[model samples]
Each structure stands twice: as C-alpha cells, then as structure tokens.
Target: MGKLSNCLSMIQILMARPKVKIDDLAAELGVKPRMIRVYRDELEKAGIYIESVRGVNGGYSLDRRSILPIRNFNSTEVQELQIAIKSYLSKQPDHDSTLDNALEKIKAAQRDQALSSKHFYFANDYLINAEVGNESEHYKRLYHAFNHRKKVMITYEAASTNAVTKRTIHPYAFVVYDENIYCVAYCEQKEALRTFKIIRIHDVVLVDQSFYLPENFDIRKQFPHLGFIREPQEVELIIDTPFSNQVKESIYSTDQIIEELPDNAIRFKATLNGEQSIKKWILGMGTKARVIAPEHLKKEIQLEVEQMLQNFQK
Candidate 1:
C-alpha cells in the first residue's frame, strides 16, 4: 500500500472500534510502531485527530462524530465492495491495477479491524471453454462507446447458432447474468434491446456515429429477468441426505420451505428464478434429487436424462 492508502487504512481502523494498540497497527500494516506515530502526525496535519491512551494497554482512538466527513464503511460494506471489484475484473483479460490497489488497502484495513469477511461469489464455469482474445481492449472500446453515446461495430458470434456476423449497436450498460458479462445494447439489426456476451464479441470498432439514449429507457424495467425483477416459478424437490443438507445451507428464495423426511431426506419448496436454472441444478445433483412439482419441469428433466442415456448407449 502507498502512503495515502496506509493513511486511509489507519483511519478505517480507528473509526471501526474504540481503540487499537500501536504495535497491533504496526503489525497489521507491516510497519514499525514508530512509523505508526508518523502516520498519526500526518493524519492530524490533515485535520483528522487521534487521541492517545496513557497506560498499559494504551492505544489510540477516534471520535467518529468529528470525522463525519470521511465515509467509513463497515466490514460487510467493504466485503461487498470487494465483490464488485472482483466482478468487474473478471470480465477483463488483465487485472485492473487501480482496483487491485484499492482492494489491497481495504484488505489491510479489514485485517487491522479484525473484521470477519463473508465471501460473495458469482459462478463463471460457463466461460471455461470460451474463446478468449484481447478482451480487455474490446471491453474498453465498448465501455467508451457506451459512455460517449457512440455506436460500435462488433463481429459477434451467436452462442445459439455459432454464426458470426457484424452489427452496429448503441451500447447501453453492462449486465451480468448467470455469471456472464453482457453488453445491454440497442441492436440496429434487431431493432430492440439485446444482450451480447462480452466474451462472444470477437471484434469491436468504435464508430464515430452518435446516438441518444431514450430518457425513459431503464434497462432493468426493459429486461425484467436480467436484473432485480425475476419471474420466479414454484419448484418442489426431494433431495437425499447430504445434498439436502447442502441445499439447506443456502437460501434460494426468501419464501423457501423445507421439511424433514425419513432416511435423512428433505422436501424442499421454493419459488426460484427460471426453470432453466432450476433444471440445471437438479441435473447437477443427478439421482440424489428429484423434482416433485411443475409436471412440465419433471418431464423436461426426464427427457434430458433419456437423451443422456441414449448418448451413453450410442
């Protein structure tokens, strides 16, 4: 961490708790106790003050009300910020050094405050076989086009058809769905809001042409399922033993209900998002889990299994 980063971290530590020992601060920041005093002096010079406690177990404390101008984030908030940084960096081919530096500072402070971190992650296994090229450059171009209200010409390979074609698009905003980054843009060819997976875009050219975004255009409202608005479907499942326990550990939906069954099985019911995601989860569990309701979903899973059997037989 740099000087500014260290100073910010020191402030974070002070604000989080009543006091921290000088030696503890030094150990957390990987510096000497004497340097801790130097940092204190530097911070006091900038109108933030730390009070010294005189005695054994003596340390430093900050009056949060006095430093109200500086925004102090709790441990949970810091963790959430880290998750956002991870999501953004995951899309780029190379790490964003600026965000990485910021993450380091936050981590230092997190350690200093003895804050327990809760991991928040998004799935990305769908991208394992993806064609990765100069993704960083493509991302930058698309971002620039979005920011400047300019159009972009992209050679995109359709995931469904595996057909590559060029199209002019008015970039709107970046959308992350099912652990993939997509550009929510107005496709001139489609004449509607469409999502193009970032990794699927093989070529990008920023066009000088300018376009205006509709003032009333809200991406979430336009594409309900992509964002906060999800049309969840009711699902019932019988999951055996450890898989049931594993499912119990996670909250698929706020209204989810679970019932203990004989032989350590569970009857689980939840209004989860989309049949596709639910179908995938059931298929992943194999014979350990079986769908109990939404008869159509049950038939679909049966069809999938039958196809798998056919493949194996062949």
Candidate 2:
C-alpha cells in the first residue's frame, strides 16, 4: 500500500482500538517494528498525535478526532459495505463508542447517494445497545483478557432472575447474536462454559493468570446459539396455523427440521441451547406455538402460565 493509505489505515486501527502494539501494526502492514516508528513520526508530522507507551505492556494510541474519507461504492460494494458495517458494529468491543458515529456516517453516505436505507444498520428490534458503562471500561478490560488469554474476575447480573454474583473466568470468545454481544468463557465457579451478556457484565479485571485454550475450541462449533450453552438439547415444537402456514420455510437454526403436519400445523425440531430462550419464544408466540416433547418444558410453561394468570387475577 502507498504511504498515505498505510498511514490512514493505521489511524483507523488506532481509532477503533484503545491501543495497539508496534508488532501488531507490523504484521498487518507487512513491515517491521522499526517501520512502525517511522510511520509514527510521519503521523506526527501530519498533525496526528500518537501517544506511545514503553514497557512489557506498552503500545500506541490516539484520541484525536479525524474524519474518515468517504468513497463511492458500486451496487455490490454498497451491499457488502452495509453487511461489513453491521457485522462490525454488532460484535464491536464493549468499549467501542465510535461505532455509532461510524454507522451514522455510513447512513449519511447512503442518504447522500440515494442508496437504499433498509438493512444498512442493524434493526434495533434485534439488538439492545445495552452497554453497562458509558465509557465502556469493563469492555476494555474484558478485551484485554480475551486478547492475552488471561483469567478475569467479573461481577455479573443475571438477565433472567436479576441475581448478582461474582466469578473468575477464562475469557475465550465474544459472540454476537441478533446484534447483541455476549462473552463466552469458562466459569470457574460453574466448572463449565457459559455465555454472559455484555450489558450484565461489570467490574471486569485481569487476574494476572494466563490460560491455554483447548485445541478444538472453535467458537462457532462450540456456540451455535451465541454461546448460551456448551451443549445442545433436542427441542420439538408444534406451531399452530396460521403462523405455521405463514412461515414459508425453515428460517431458524440451520439444523432445524420443519415438517408440515396433517392438521395444517408445523412441527419444528432442532437441537438448541438455552431453554429459557426457547421458553420465552414460545410464550411470546402465545397460543400459536406449543412444546411437543420434553415434558419438563411443557410443565414449566404450564406453571408459568398459572403464575401469569394468578398475577392477572390479582
């Protein structure tokens, strides 16, 4: 890449991340650590101030405001760009607040050129911009643990029960589902892998302990439903018409099997994690959906209905 393009790329990287090491820049730019020093000097000359830290955990960063150059995109590139932006924003580090501005800029570009606006941004319905801190310091620390494969201690508030607890975890991966961010980690207390919503996480601190991830620890293979559970359980549901008939085809998990029943309903079966999530989905559907097998889930739903009815009567 040309020097000017390289400099801009470096600036963008620094802006997106809290800090980056010279080694990282070198690898990305196909250069040497010494070349990073030269680029830093060049950036300084261009009125871009990059703060450098020296030590074992040292790197460079900048907080100055800089406008990204806009480019015209072809039809295919526009679609790809929208997808790229949505993907990035959906899984951005918790400390990343500039994503909103970046998305706004993309929207502006689309509006200026009269491009289609639909699907340019993640649908708000699917995502909760549920940030725990305004400055996102927790996200930053969590990222540190993830990047270095370190153990981290965290205080987490449960989304279902609102119960709060503390645990130490070996940070593994960050998964994005329906535009929401979740951290998948091995919880020391649970002795298993669990997914924690980013919004429910707080007080994340590196435990000064390192960990080696398992050899087959692929995030996608390990987490099909955003890391909610490490294991998948068989789930069978009966969808009543006209919702069942309205569903044109299988749209949920790729492994889901949908069969048209003789009674004009649909039978849906899939191995999934997160019983609570499925329960909530079923409850949301009201009378339109019912659990078939797994008698325990049916009873759980029955009790939930009873409780709701009792509450309404009160």
Candidate 3:
C-alpha cells in the first residue's frame, strides 16, 4: 500500500485494537521492523501519540488524550473527509498541484487547532459535490486571502436583486453549502458578516489589507439551518417504494421523519428550505409521490404543473 493508505490503515488498526506488537505492524504493512519504526515517527509527527510498552507483553497503544476528533471518524466518515479536502483543492485552477501540496501538509497537521466543533462530524453519507467552473481562478486567489487573513475586493452579482456591486471584504473562510460554494466574509458595505456564493462573484482581487478571524467566528454557528436555501418551511410527501429512498437522500434532506405506510408506501415529512427546490423535487417524482400537507405549496405546484402542460402543448 501507498504511504497515505498505510497511515490510514495504521490509524484504523490502532483504533480497533488495544495494543499491537511492532512485529505485527511490520507484517501488516509488509515492511521491515525498521520501517515500522519509521511509520511510528511519521504518525507521531501527525500528532497521533502512540505509547510503547517495554515488557514481555510489549506492544503499541494510542494516547487517548493525543487523539484528535478524527479518531471519532469511521471508514464512511473518512470518505467524507476525502470529499471535503477534494472540494477545497478543486476550487483552484492548479488543483492537482494544490492537492498534492495540501496532502503533504495534512499528513503533519491534526487540524484540531483549526476546528471549532468538539465532535467534528455526524454519520451521514451526504457527499459535497460543488461546481467551481471558470471562477476557479478567482477562487484560488480568494482562497489564499482567507488563509492568510487578508481582505479582498470583489465585484459581486447579487442573487436576490440581480445587481452587480463592488465591495471590500475581510474573508473568514470558504465553505460549501448545499453544494454551492460560499465565502463567509465580513462585508464592509453591509458592515455585517454575509454569505456570498462564489459563482456570483464576477471578479475578485486581493487587497493589501490583513485581518483576523474573530475568536468566536465559526461557519457552522453562523449558518446552521438545515435547509440550504432561503428559509425552511413545513411539508409532507407520501411516496411509493420506488421514490422513497430518493426523497430521503435529497439535498434538502433536513429534519426528516419517515414512516412506513400501508401497501409499501412511505410517508416522508420534512421542514426543508427552498419552496421552489421542494416543488421541483416532488414534480420530478410524478405519480410516485404526492404532497400531503401545506395547501399553498400544493396550489403552487398545481399552477406550476399547469404552466408546464401549457408549454408542452404549444
């Protein structure tokens, strides 16, 4: 196995077992006992504190206190970590080079210093697939700005007003919300921290201005709503067997309650964000799903369907 795969495997083995002998680890990694010692040094540099017992029952054990929150991640969650890192690097034009450089550094930093959450994640297979497009060049520029605590000037096109405006912002961080990449920055125009979708930024340039991320600043704390777009609204959808899994796995899958209905149907209820988003999803399901509540949303869907039928007939 490659170095990184071996590192992750070593972590998994140590996490699962109480103690493992050096010979055992050497055999598991298909390397000499000398190389096992080298792996031990690498893991130690990464802040994985392995304690060696020098006795007849000698073996290696992880220091519980030295474990970062990554120790809490299972194999599935490890995959999520890969996606998160990939998305960050993909936003840069020189992604391949950036990813290689980042991985080398990641092998050394636990990232516990950068983390705000005591428990960094929850069990959800939902993967991040953000689209960066040609804006990746600017994204690359602004990405460094956030990293270095530098301010940036951006010509932004507002999604709500469709107005283009220029603003100087102190960038806190870049985050992916609802598969859309956003720069959570302190906007000088509004004098407030706001979420700006990276795609809507028409132009961006780094300013010579430097700033600090507020001691209390946290992206999750700023925007913790389950619904990814607009505001959340209550809705219930009754779906047949064929459509059940799709609704549960949807992008707006927030605060969901699923109950089995008679004759192989599922009742799925959720307080989801984005009225238009949910309408489009239900429409896509067609005969497989039906709305059970919210008369206004049902009426909106009916009108939307009517407009679609008119377009089809023309």
Candidate 4:
C-alpha cells in the first residue's frame, strides 16, 4: 500500500482499538516494530496525540480528546470526503498555484495521520451522481445567495404543470434529502415561503437586494414542523414492529414521543410542517407502516399509492 494509504489505515486501527501494542501494529502493517515507531512519530508531527504506555501492559493509544473527528469515519465516508476534496480542488482556477500547493500539504498531513489499512478493507461503492447542467449552476447560485442573505431571481418550472415562471425570492437555506436538493426561500410573488427543487430551476440570478432573517427563524426547528413550504401541522403515524424502531430513529429525534403498543407496534407523533416529506417517508416503508390519525393524510397516502400502482401498470 502507498504511504498515505498506510497512514490512514494505521490511524483508523488505532482509533478503533486504542492501547494496541507496537508489535501488533507492526504485525498488522507487515513491518518491523521500529517502523511502527516511525509511523507514530510521523503521526505526532501531523498533530495526532499517540500516548504510549510502557512496562508489562505497555501499548499505544490515541488521546481521544485531542484526536480530530476524521479518525471515526467509516471507509465509505472517507472515500466521499476524498471525492469532495478533489472536487473542490478541481474547481480552483488554474492561476491559483499557491492554493494548490497548500492543499497538497494539507492532504499530506491528513494522509500521515490516518490509518493505512482503512482504505484497503473495502472498495468505495458510493457514487455521488450529481447532474451537471443549468440545474447544478442554479443550485450553486442559490447556495451562495442563501449564505450571503441575498435575494435571487429565478425562472422556475413548476412541477405540477411544467409551466415556466419568473419570480424573486429571499433564499433562506437548502435541504438535501434523498437524491435531490431543495431550496427554501421566501417567494415575493407568492407572498409565502416556498420550496423549489434545484432541478426545476431553469435560470437563477443573484440579486443585489438583501433581506433580514427573522429572529424566530430556526431552520431545524421549523424544518421538522413546517418543512420548507408548508405551515406546521400535527400528524400521527402507526408503525408495525421491527420497522417501528427504524422509523422512530430515522424520523423523530429525542424530542418526539414514541409509544409502544401491545401488538408490538409503535406509534409516532410529531408536529411537522410539510406532510409531503413525511408522507413519502411512510410510503417508502411499504406495508410495515400505516397512517392512523388525520383522516385527510391517510387518504392522501392511499391515493398516492394507487396512483403509483397505476403508473407501474402502464
């Protein structure tokens, strides 16, 4: 394996099983114990804290508080991180040689501090297939506008009718759920908050106008209850066993209530803003879940499933 790869593997191993002896590391790396010391020194130079305990119970372990969070990444996450880093680097202009040089140094430091075998155990299978076109450009512009608290003028193609219309919006933030990116913005034309899919934006232009974010505007708090476009609404769902745990853990955080039923089923209740997102989530669970309360929502989900079945038959 390459030096950088080896280093990353070593770091992962140490993080997973701290207090591992030098001899064991050498055995795992297929090198002499002396060489393990060299790798340890390299890690220390790169700002990793490798505490060595001596005597009969002597071994090396990471000082958990001092070690960076990257040490905990699974192999897939590491590969994704590498791709993101490369993508960012590739976007830098050709004239930015100094920045490129600095990036190389940073990469080297990261490689030296990481566990070498971490990259060897598994093949990276997660591929991020982001569509690169006008939609991608719109996403970038929207992200910038949201970050800078600026308004944006966009030509959006409505999903329901596919009609194109121009509108001005105060871009608030973005939510990347499932495989799509959504922009949460205050639409001046609609006089209400709206969520626009980045894919449906035909054109986007950052406007000079800026807007003030409300003091009560907490993205996480509002997102779960009201979603990007919808007003907050109370919704209850009945989930069957095995799937109940998955549903509860995935959808509701610690704040939400989860009640266990005698039938080994689980009931989840939450005040969500956008029913659409949660509805889609329940449908994804298949027959394992059913919406009990709010007669309208239950009917909506049933209708959606029937429509899906019809589309499939075609």
Candidate 5:
C-alpha cells in the first residue's frame, strides 16, 4: 500500500484499539518510527486524537472520545460543511472555491463527526488593505519564526519618523489591528517586548538560533493596553455634549471610564500608547472629541486642523 493508504489503515487499527505502542505498531505495519510520527501528525490534522503517553508501559493512544464511529451525514449536514469550509477559504488571499468543493466531497465520503463539529465562522467589519511587496515575505518569515521558536533578523521601519533599521528579535505572535499586521516579538536590541508593523518591515532573515518561551508568558495578558497602536501612554478626555457616546464606543483605549454629566454631556478617560495613532483617531472624530488633559495634544490637534483648513482653502 502507498504511504497515504498505509496511514489510513494505521488510523483504522488504532481506532479499533485505543492504546497501542508506537514500536509495536511500526513493527506490525513494517514502517519506521519516523514514518509513524508523520502518520500521527496527518491523523491529527484529520481531527483524530493521537496522544503520546510516558513511562515504562506508556505508548500512543487514540484518545477514547476520538475513537467514536463516524456519523451519517444528511444533505443539510453536507451543505453546512461545504459552506463552512468555503467561508474559511474565502478569508485567505489565494484560496479558491474548488478546494472547498473537494473538502466537501471528502467530508461526504468520510462522514466524520469531528469534521462536522469543526465548523468555521468569522466576523470582520473594518477594511484591510492587502499587504504588498517585501512586507508579505517578512510576515511569512516572522510567522515561521514564531511557530518554530526561532530567532529572526528584521529591517523594520519606525512609525515615528519612518526611519529603517535592522534588529534581531524572537517572534512571539502576530497581532492584527486597524487593518494592519504587527509582529509582537521580544527585541534583542531593546531587551523588551515590541510590536513591529509588517508593512514597515523592509526585509527579514530567519536565524537558526532558537529559544524557549517562558512558562508564565501569556501574550494577551501582558499587552492589555495594546490596541491598533502598540505604544504605551495614557490620556484622559472630557468630551462635550452630543459626542460623548460616540467617542466612548469608537475610540480605541485601554480603560474607558465614562461619567455622565448634568447637561447631557459625558466624560471619558482612556489609557493609550502611540501618540500618532491617537492623534489620527482624534482627527477622525473632527469636533466631536475634546482633549481634557495634556495641553500639548490639544495644541497638536489645533495645528493639524489649521493645516488641513489651509490645504482646503488653497
């Protein structure tokens, strides 16, 4: 039998007997231990649970629940599966409907309950510009670095002055905000966690050097104040009447403290980083937003508006 056929047969055998030794299986199938590992990965992708056990008598097992028999698929179930797969594929830049059709046929043939249960759904409201140029390549490299726990060298563009410089970093995760992709990595140069915009990356090179992630490290918990902008700063504002509610929901801030006023107005406070991002956001709100604290920010906004008016008048 071919490798694919052999792998399928191995899954069937493992399903019949939940607990089976890797060595015993390899001997029985006349395949090497390396091939067994490969087949195990393929089985996992197919939604089968193959877990390794440790100790003297420990081996591999098709997790009890995952060994359940395939469920019959009705027309509705098949259509739902097809729709779910197509929806997921649509999110990718290069995927097409044909792949979705093929997956649907495969699901129909297998009638796998796990596949049926593993449906895809997503919701997106903002418009994202398709990334271009070396940026895409940089993103791919960073993604691989994160997946493989490897270090990388990246030429990055700073948002403040658009200055480009090279730095070595340990990629932790990729974050998407304001329709832009960012690499949240541990910067070796800075000795701190920093977020790099993919669009700003001029080039990337993966290095063989690898590092282990700290056990207590949780990206989401560490960057609670992060939004579209990755910088760290705090700002409080008291928005005048008629604009407070809109500002409360639309503005991206860490902690939004809203206080109702006597004259139908509201006060909002939020911690923000990335002054440029906040400035742009304030400009987007036009007159609806008012800067309560930090006199410099208000002045900056005034100057920007004046410049904008000058352009329009000309």
Candidate 6:
C-alpha cells in the first residue's frame, strides 16, 4: 500500500481495536513500526487525532465520535431508496432518466464505500417523512402491502367508539397529517374506502392475495380534507400570547388566517374540515385557547368543561 493507503488502514485498525500496538499496526499494513508513528502524525494533521497510551500495555486508539462524519449507506437503506425511486417512476407515465441515473449512482456509491471501509451498517427501516416520528414495523408492512398491491389483515381500534375489529384492507397510500400517520385503504368489512390511523392499528398481517389499484383513483380527490373526512366548518379561535405563537407556526388548514390583537393575542380563523378534530385541539390548549366563532362548538366546549367539573366534584 502507498502512504495514504497505509494511513487509512492504520486508522481503520485503531477504530476496530482499542489500543492497537504499533508493531501490530505495522504488520497489518505491511509497513515499519516507525511508519505507524508517521501515519499517526499525518492523521493528526487531518483532524483525526489518535490517543496514544504509555507503558508496556500502551498503544494507540481513535475516538469513534471523530470519524462519524464519514457518510456511507447500508444495503437496506440503498434498497429502500431504490424502491422509493421506482415507486415514484411507476406513477409517472414518461420515463425519467434522471431518477434512473440517481438510483444507479447510489448503488455504485454503496459498492465503492463497502470496498473502501469496514463500516458497522445497521439494516434498520428507513423513516418515511411523516408525522409518525420513527418508522414502526406496522409502517413497513403497510408500505410493502401498498407497493405490491396486496391486502393485509389488521387489528384496528376505532377512535370514536374504541371498538376493536379484525379486517382485511387494500392499502392505497400513506398519508401524514396533523402530526399523525394514516393509511387510506379500501376496507373489506365496510366495502368502502376509509382512512385509518397507523398508531391505532395494533397488528398487521400481509395476505397473499393481490389487488389492482384503479388508474383513476386519486387520494387527494377522494379525501380532499385528508384525515378530517367530514363536513367542513369555518372555525375561529382566540389564542393567548405564547400559545398563539405556536398556533401561528402551523397551518391547521390551507385557508387559515391570523390577526394580532392589542393584548398580544391572536384571532385565528380557518376553514377546518370537521368540528371533532378541531374541538379536541382547542381542549388540548387548556386555558390558553378559546373558541370564538361557531356557537355550537363553543357550547360543546362549555359542556365538556362542566362535565369535567362535575366528575371532579364526585
């Protein structure tokens, strides 16, 4: 190996073993013991400092944190990227050479990285950019079913009645809304398309049977309001100070508007999809939020508060 190759090899050795003897590093790289010390000096100049221990049992070790900037993709991650790219291309009628080239480049880079370095790559599921936070096993199964046009048997809990039922569903696509994960699927039990929360799904089993997705089926057209697939309502709220700032940062609806009050509060207005989800949000804000418009919603909040007081008194 050349000078640069010997330096990288020495660093790799230090990473794998804690306190590698200078003689061992030289033997591994087919270089002199003195050359190992030279490699350490070169590495230190490149901001990768090796810690040298003293006495008989002493050797050199590299801090793992310092070398973490090296970017490398594992097999699972590379495969997931390729799958996403293909999924995207499948939707487009025209052939996109750009995305195809990108996939090839990613694969080439993965192979090159594997040959150059011995990295401890984890085969974990790639997190989908959704409000679901970390990707779960349920997400992976649903994604697989969606991609393959297969049906899945899921044990689901209903948010309204807390009813649990086992049903088979043909998942259409994954939708992220209101900091949550939802799957738009055709429910076999209901014989209609329904949106389900991924978290509420307790278990998922992939079925062998495959289904065909309708070419004209568009998720956006079907669920114009997304998760809040209900009667649309024009809602208004008076949010106080710090809490108002929080509300301003997020768009509850596409047509949302905000106005600043003299007292530093905010008057928020939006054409939200339904009253149920919006009511829950107002209640969650506690004393900092109050409903201004929609008399029915205000009365409901008042009623809920009264019920809470009565329960506490009992």
- Of candidates 6 and 2, the better by TM-score: 6
Residue pairs whose backbone atoms clash in candidate 3: none
Candidate scoring better on lDDT of 1 and 3: 1
Off by over 4 Å in 5: 1-135, 151-153, 156-169, 174-200, 207-211, 220-234, 238-243, 246-255, 261-265
Which ten-residue region of model 2 has the weakest summed lDDT? 117-126
TM-score of every candidate relative to the true structure: 0.51, 0.43, 0.61, 0.44, 0.46, 0.50
Question: Candidates sorted by lDDT, descending order?
Answer: 1, 6, 3, 2, 4, 5
When sorted by TM-score, best at the front, the candidate numbers are 3, 1, 6, 5, 4, 2
Error of 6 at 230 (Å): 1.7
Better of 3 and 6 by lDDT: 6
User: In model 2, how large is the Cα lDDT of residue 247?
Assistant: 39
The CA lDDT of each predicted structure is 0.70, 0.65, 0.66, 0.64, 0.64, 0.70
Query: Candidate 1: where is the Cα deviation over 4 Å?
Result: 1-17, 20-151, 157-171, 178-181, 186-193, 206-222, 225-232
Question: Would you give me the overall lDDT of model 1?
Answer: 0.70
In angstroms, the error of model 5 at 122 is: 18
Write the residue-wise lDDT of candidate 1 on 142-250 in tens digits.
8677657899999999988999999999987654445445677889998987878888889999899999977666554555544533656788999996677766665
Q: Least lDDT summed over 10 consecutive residues: which range in candidate 5?
A: 118-127
Best by TM-score: 3
Q: Model 4: runs farther than 4 Å from truth?
A: 1-173, 177-180, 183-197, 203-229, 251-255, 309-314
Candidate 3, run of 10 with poorest lDDT: 118-127
Cα deviation at 174, candidate 6, in Å, is 2.4
Q: Stretches of candidate 3 above 4 Å error?
A: 1-39, 46-58, 61-140, 159-163, 174-179, 224-231, 248-255
TM-score of 3: 0.61
